[model samples]
Target: MTKVIAIVNQKGGVAKTTTAINVGAGLAKHNKRVLLIDLDGQGNLSRGLGCKTKARNQFTIRDALLNIQKGILTNPTKGILTARYEKISVMPANKQLDAFEHSLKGDLDAPFYLRRYVNTLRQYFDVILIDCSPSLGLMTLNALVAADSVMIPVDPEFFGVEGVEQIVAAMTDVQRKMNPSLSLEGIVIVRRNDISIAKRTNAKNLRLRYGSKVFQTELPTSVKASEASARGMSLLEYMSWNHLARAYASLVEEVLANGRN
Candidate 1:
């Protein structure tokens, strides 16, 4: 069975897309067949994987969902793009997705569209990771409904706890009213600078509150990571010797262990 995990956070700039890219790449390194779904209209995840979202006649996540909604048939692999990386595929998205969300208004079954679409592709992949937008809107809700689990990324900021609270509340609501089997995979602390007192305190507070739900490995902020993303490559592929890349490797180990449990 395919394990679908949504990389989500209600707040932006917390490395949500970055985490999604590296984590999916890391899992692929372990020989896991991974499919990345870009649910954000920004299309950052697609670009980060070196996908040409603006290329002529390129089908996007927007097209896939709308096609699913309208019951239109084209090709089985209509919207999926093979990334340059190993063992990974992507369903790209673009700015047109923002308008696509609004068109689903008044549609009673809007929230289940992604779930329905994903059901058709479950047989081919070992894992599916959905990188969501920074809001808990209709698109993110669709991700939640389709996913078996969610992994939240948080920066060590003052408001990090508050942001986690909101997403957890949304997860709770989804559990009650939608996908009852959905679970929280874990909370990953990203972009940490241990030298800063405020960041240290904030991270300590998060661990104290969330306890074992927080991953033991925290990702350090690095210019190399940003540069790698700018060049459309994951840190592990761009600079495997970097400390941030090693940290992601450790996190992937934890993710695998958690899956076994």
Candidate 2:
């Protein structure tokens, strides 16, 4: 069965996309067929996976949503970009998603559209990870509704804890009203060198707050992550020996251990 995991955080720079990219890569490295869906209008996830998406790129989540709106399931694989030697495929996004959301204003089923779209994709891949835009909007709602679980990437900073609270509340609301199946899988601390008392305190607070729901794996601040993004590649592909790769690989194991729980 296919499992959908949405990596989300309303705050930007929290490594939501970074977690999505590397975790997908990590899963693919283990020979899992993965499909990454970029729901962010910035298309950073798409680009980070090596897609050179342009302004006029119409082949995106927009078209897929439109198809769902038309009461049909779209064959989105036609536009999915292959990466990491075909172990991973991505449905790229563009600025068009901004307009797509605008067009969804007042649509009662805006959040359900992505669920409907993803329902058609479960058979093709072992995993489908949605890289949500840094907000709890219709897109993220849709992601939550479609996903089996959510993974939040919290930066080792003050606001990171606050943002996790916001997202957790939002997910609870979504579970109550939209997707009762949506459970928060775990929270991963990112950019965490833990070199300072403050960072260590923040980590402790998060684990205390979320308990075992917080993932044991934490990614330290690494320049190699930035370099990998600059090269439009996953850290594992860019430098397999990098500690970041090892961290993400461990994260993948934790995720699989969770195993639809």
Candidate 3:
């Protein structure tokens, strides 16, 4: 059985994609087979994992959903694409995904497409991480409905508190009206600078509200992340000896412990 966790945040620049990539990669390094699904049409996670989403025949998550909807692809698992990282697979997405979402706009079952697609790949992986867009739209709703749990990466900035509130409300709605089995994996505070009073104050607020849901690990701002992305690699592969890698590794441990698959 695979534990499907969606790395989600309604606000951009919260390191949602970074957390998804590193956590998936870190789990892979633990000898656990992991698959990363890029739910965001922007394809950031796809590019971060060394996948260039260009041609339609390449088969993205969007293509899989559309193909399944149109009766073109019978097996949803066939859409899983191999990434550069070992022990991990990816269902890449690109800008074309926007059109696919539009195609399913008012369809009653649109929110369940990802759940149906993930059902076919459950036995093949230990974990599946869906990197969602920074919004509470249909795409994010699909990921939330499909996932067993959700992990939010809240940046330590001012609006991070508001972002957390918005997501919490959405998650509550999902559990009530969509997926009743949905659980919160954890809330990770990203890009924290302990010395900055503003960052410290915001993080304190998050802890006061979410309490134990917040992970102990706080990922600091790192130029290495961008450098790694430039080279199309995870932080684990980019600089495994550094603190950034260790932070992500610690987060992975929490992720594994929280998720019951």
The prediction achieving the highest lDDT against the true structure is 1
lDDT of 1: 0.89
For TM-score, candidate 2 versus 3, the one ahead is 3
Cα RMSD of predicted structure 2 = 1.7
Total clashing residue pairs per candidate? Answer: 0, 0, 0
* Alpha-carbon deviation at 154 in model 3, angstroms: 0.6
Deviation from truth (RMSD, Å), model 1: 1.3
Question: Which window of 10 residues has the lowest lDDT sum in candidate 1?
Answer: 155-164
Tell me model 3's lDDT, rounded to 2 decimals: 0.85
Give the best candidate by TM-score. Answer: 1
Q: What tens digits encode model 3's per-residue C-alpha lDDT throughout 1-261?
A: 679999888888788998888998899998889999999889998899888798647778887887657657476577677767545798899988988988897799899888888877888888999999988999899999999999998877655578788898999999999899999888999887656787788899999988999998999888898888777789988898778888999988887777643
Clashing pairs in 1: none
Model 2, residue 23: C-alpha shift (Å): 0.4
All candidates: TM-score: 0.96, 0.94, 0.95
Q: What does the lDDT read for residue 90 in candidate 2? A: 90
> What digit string (tens of lDDT, one per residue) describes model 1 on residues 47-165?
99888899888899999998889999767567798876545799999999999999899999999999988888888788899999989999999999999999998887644677788
